[model samples]
Target chain A: MKENNSFILGIKHGIPICLGYLSVSFAFGIFAVGSGLSVIEALLISMFNLTSAGQLAAVPIITGGGGIPELALAQLIINLRYSLMSVTLSQKLGKTVSALDRFWIGFGITDEIFAVSTSKNKSVGRKYMFGLILTPYAGWSLGTLLGSVAGNILPDSVSSALGIAIYGMFIAIVLPTVKKHLPTALCVVGAIAIGCAFKYIPMLSRVPDGFVIIIAAVVASMVAALLSPVSDEESEQTDEKEVNTDA
Target chain B: MPSMNFFFHLGVMAGITYLVRMLPLVLVNKKIRNRFLLSFLYYVPYAVLSVMTVPAIFYATSSPWSALAGFVIAMILAFFEKSLLTVAIFSSAAVFVTEFLLPIIQ
Candidate 1:
């Protein structure tokens, strides 16, 4: 009964994540198809790779016939942050959570899951974490499937317009926190400025989009972390713990 | 797209990404008490999302102008802390309308 309740709780909390992913992944689906992935390919991509940044970023590179190493490298850099989240969450799960549950649940620990799970002052159990990840997982997959199918049907002009959906989703995820937090706000501006520099500067322009994202994220984040290291007490809410920006 | 290469990339991307998550979860059984690393990890999401949004967004629309309009619309919605889906839908709709109206005016 308790497991079921937490499962339900996870779904309840995950509803917004599901809803948001449905549209953002819709954009990804269309973007994937627009970039030449088959509908099934797009769906599978969403299924296999749940996060938005790496999967969506990989599409252009993959479609352009980039190599396995390039794709692997992109996944590593983009998703590496999750490692920190996983470690953070692992402590929350604690010794009570079995090794088996820990392994499986880690798969679901995206930004939102981490944020929501960590937000609980009490330690989170296996069931709650599983429950939390479920809705967003379904939402992500379902949205991608729909988007892939829709991509085949939508006209180019409209599909092109829809392309902004992914970025819009990113903005919605980050903008609120950036507004509330000065360090986070600086981090956004700094990342964008670096990203733009890579694009316009002649020498840096040759860098692949994948490399550029990795470099910008790492460098800007490192700087911000130095400038504004959170006291240990304020860290949990500072997440990262959501699709709220967690995923 | 060649099936062989596609699957290869998929396998590698999924494999490495999974390892990234799994290692930390399974291995790091103890809680991190370190302030410095904790602070750094906290900033990761904001940085990642920010870098991912730009340059690429410019090309997601029929025109850069349309994308910019959508971005502006999204920023406004997000500033007021609207739901994610609301921000995305409204912004995309804004982009679609801008795209549609542009050719007529131009």
Candidate 2:
């Protein structure tokens, strides 16, 4: 009965995440197809890899004929922050989550899932984790499937507008926090400045898109860390705010 | 577009992403004590997402102006703490409207 209850609660919590992912992944579906990937390939990509930013970054590299090393490095850099979330979430696991269950649970630890699970007052268990992950996974894959299919049929004017949907989502994720938090606002500003330099400067503009993201992210994050180190207590508050960022 | 090569590349990307998530939860039993590292990780999503959004967003639509309109709408909605879907949809709508009107205005 207890197991069933947590599972239900997990599903309830996950519904919102699932709904949010539907739109974002729908945009991803359209973007991937617009970028020349077959609809099935886009669907397969979403099903196999649930990382939104990671997959978004990967599509360009894949379509551009980037090599294995470049694609690997791009995924690693773009998705590396999940490691931190996974590490943090590991501490919240209950005894019901055995060592083996860690691997399964880890697969579902996107930014939103990690936030949802960790925000719970009780320790997360295997059943609860499974229940929580299932809905969002379905929503993500389904959204992509729908969007990719629609991409082929949607008019160019509409599809072109849809291209900004993902970026709009990103801005939505980053800007709200910027209003409330100083370090985050500064970090975003600094990163955008660096990003602009890479996009416009004659010499630096030659750097590939993959490397530019790496440099901008690493340098800005390192600077923020050095300038405004967040203490453990402070980190907890940030985690609460993270519920809105990734989905 | 080669079937075998596409599958191979897809596997590599998915494999690397899975390993990044899995390795940490499986290996790290204790909380990381490094404050600097933790801070860096905390700020990483912001940095990376911001870098990806800007300049690129400006080019996401048919015209930079339309993209900017979408971006501005997104930022305003986000500033007011609108839901993610609301912001995203409205931003796209803003772009659509801007693109439709740009020709007449020009």
Candidate 3:
């Protein structure tokens, strides 16, 4: 009964995430189809690969007929951030959630879900995380289906405008914390500057998007972490079940 | 078209992504004691999102002006603490309207 309630709550919280994802994934679906992948292939990619940025980065390589080594390397750099996220989230899981559960959650954790689960005032459990993950998961897959079908029939101007919707979602994610935290705001600015340099600088302009994101994220975050280490209170493990889970 | 190449590329992407995510969860069962590293992890999402949004957002629409308008609308809506759905929808609408009106004005 309790699991059901938490799952419902997760779905509730996920509603907005689902809505945001629908638009973004719709954009991606269009991009994928444009790149020559069939709707089923695009849909499968979105369903199997939930990480938005990583999948977007993969499109060009997949379309280019790049070798597996290049594809894997790109995936590694672009998706590496999730490894860090899962590590942080692992500390928050309680004993009730098993190692197998953690593995499942880890695979499902995206930026939005991680942000929502961690911000809870109380320790998050498997039920809530599961609840939280389910909606966005559906939203992404459904959005891909919608985007793929819709993209082909849409007028060029409308499709072109819809292209930026995913970026808008990214903006929404950062804006909330950016308002409250100086370091977070600066980190964003620094990352953007780094990204721009890669795009504009003659020598570095040829760098791939995945490499650029990896570099910006690593360099900017390392500097922020050093300069603005969070207060001890914030770092205290709040998950009530964290201790028992480790055993 | 050899089906092997297509499946091979997708498989590699999926496998690598899944491994990176699952490995950390399975391997790091203990709480991290290091504050700096924790803070660094905390900022990764923000940095990643920021880098991906800028420059890229500028190119998302047919016209730079339309994309810029939509991006500005998104920032303003986000600044007011609008829900993600609201921000995205309104911003996309902003782009749509701008794209529609641009040729008329020209």
Best by lDDT: 2
List the lowest-lDDT window of 10 residues for candidate 3 chain A: A238-247
Q: Tell me how far the alpha carbon of residue B31 in candidate 1 is from the true structure, in angstroms, after superposition.
A: 1.9
* Rank ordering of all candidates by TM-score, starting from the highest: 2, 1, 3
Instruction: List candidate 3 segments past 4 Å from native.
Output: A1-20, A34-36, A64-74, A88-102, A112-132, A232-247, B1-3
Tell how far residue B9 is off in model 3, in angstroms. 2.4
Interface RMSD in Å per candidate, to 1 decimal? 1.9, 1.5, 4.1
RMSD of 1: 2.8
Candidate 2 per-residue lDDT over residues B2-106, each given as its tens digit:
388789889999899999999999998788899999899888888988998988998889999998899889989989888778888899999999999999999
> Which ranges of candidate 2 are over 4 A from the true structure?
A1-5, A244-247
TM per candidate: 0.91, 0.95, 0.83
Which TM-score values does chain B get in all models?
0.91, 0.93, 0.88
Scored by CA lDDT, what does every candidate get?
0.80, 0.87, 0.77
Candidate 1, residue A114: lDDT: 72
Candidate 1's docking class is: medium
The fraction of correct interface contacts reproduced by each prediction comes to: 0.80, 0.82, 0.74
Model 3 lDDT per residue over B1-106, tens place: 3266677777888888999988998898676777887787677767887887898888877899999999999999888767666777788899999988999999
The TM-score that candidate 1 achieves is: 0.91
